[model samples]
Target: MRADPNLYDYWPYRDRPKIVWPGGKKLAFWIAPNIEFYEFDPPKNPSRPGWPKPSPDVVGYSQRDWGNRVGHWRLMELMDRFGLRGSISLSTALIDHHPEIIEACVARDWEFFSHGIYNTRYSYGMDEAQERAIIEDSIRSIQTATGQRIRGYLAPALTHTERTFDLLAEYDFWYTCDLFQDDQPQPLKTKGGRLVSMPYSLEVNDVITYGALAMDPWRYADVLKRHFDQLLEEGERSGTVMCIPLHAYLVSQPHRIRAFEDALAHIAGHAADVWFATAAEIAQVYREQYWDQTVADIEARGLASGGTGFGPAED
Candidate 1:
């Protein structure tokens, strides 16, 4: 059974806003580049315990060696071509297997957000202790590999338990991007304190748009550009942030990578007042500047009052 949907409402947790960016034209845009690599251990039976596995056809075709290599190179190439700094939602097991990738990430100063140890390991059934151990182990492994302590997390398959926030706070992570709250940054109430929930885009996510939707590069680029343009227009009216989630396995494909590249170039060409930022930077700003302290002084009070009324918060 699914948990009560209202459990995910996050607006009541925001702190009051403050002026910090000096110029009101500051617009923060973040790209989440997720890396999900794992050893393909084919299940012996359909009823094997764990999260549901993809069909043999999907997994078999998806795990092509050339596809993985092409995906990796495409990501590196995009980073170089656009000079883009991104948050890598990485699986610790993958990093452990590919130390060179970790080395290159260190050289490029890319931020690593924990995406658990493997893409197939679901945390939903774990006890609090087991979950905490998994979280801590991921942090330690990623930190050891990259020489940088990870501060953010994205749950595998977006599957998480109620204890996830408290566990993340216990590990001293600054924030988490598991939420689909909005196109802007906001705070999440935790047992320890308010942990910022950095917004992540499911609509523009390449995993779905490219892999699942089967959209061509041009269509994908158009979809991304439309979102960017809408966000820019909204930002001009009300200072809001845009978060775009891209997966290395999907977006790094030769056909799809060009679409992403085109979208980046389009944004850059049209960029006059946009702030392309890392997730860490966006979290820092939200923590330091935009958190709403009281209802009377909140900038986006409508969000808290169920303006969209789309998510569980409305109920």
Candidate 2:
């Protein structure tokens, strides 16, 4: 199948504009605590199923609900103890269903951004108008609840249509976590507006680590340490972004919390080497200082041609 032309450019990582994070640090670090609300019996999308099994999946729903009720508080307390502020990937409907969670996060001055109306909702199979409505709903819901304009988006259940990026730019969203194209922030080629893709982890995510990879807590911790260590080394040459995407139900589980805490502590120990910042902070800085320069540099390198060529064959 031919690749869609509207997505983004083909700038490689080997040599690109070097990003210097604030505080003269090598790596910019952020934590994303996905505060979600999974519905008990949500509508199914034609393109994808909501529940793994069937509707009225009480076990699945309640288990995820556990995150909001008990697990999130534990995770928040731990983050507070470590002096780490959260950049929340929120399900906007929670403002109505679980205002207490929103209040708690807001009280900490955490950055709030949309993950869509609810975790159970999917963006797949949505027409352009439907998708635009969803984006509007998220913007209005979040603005009403938190009194802040959302600048970032991580599509609900990581689902999206061809038009998602362009629409986000049209609606004034500054960054997206959906594109996992690089370790550093990169410009997205939207139709006629500005948008950048921030680095959001799938590899080091608690859900992927424990659920998909089936790794234990300690193994997950080891993975975090190793990932941080290598990125820290490479970042000295050029700044890199490291994100730990978390789900409270997974990482805040009693058996898993200590190991995850240990990993955060290890990373924080090198405070002088990394810029621990919110996603908004990173995006704002890049937009102001480095975005135009980065676009110019990519264009200069002849990387924006968007051809299918993979360069010359290996010697």
| Model 2 ranges off by over 4 Å | 1-6, 306-315
User: Model 1, 41-136: lDDT tens per residue?
Assistant: 633322233324554445544654343456766777777777778788887887766777777777888889898887667776778888888888
User: Could you give candidate 2's per-residue lDDT for residues 1-315 as a string of tens digits?
Assistant: 234533566677787767788989999999999999888888877877788989888888887889889999999999999899999999989899999999888899999999999888898778999999989999999988988899999999999876788899899999999988789898787765668899999999988999999999999999999999999998988899999999998999999999999999999999999999999999999989989988798779876654222222122
What lDDT score goes with residue 182 in model 2?
84
Model 2 error, position 150 (Å)? 0.4
The TM-score of candidate 2 is 0.95
Every candidate's lDDT: 0.69, 0.88
lDDT of 2 at 105: 86
Q: What TM-score does model 1 achieve against the real structure?
A: 0.83
Candidate 1, which ten residues in sequence have the lowest lDDT sum? 306-315
**What's the lDDT for candidate 2?**
0.88
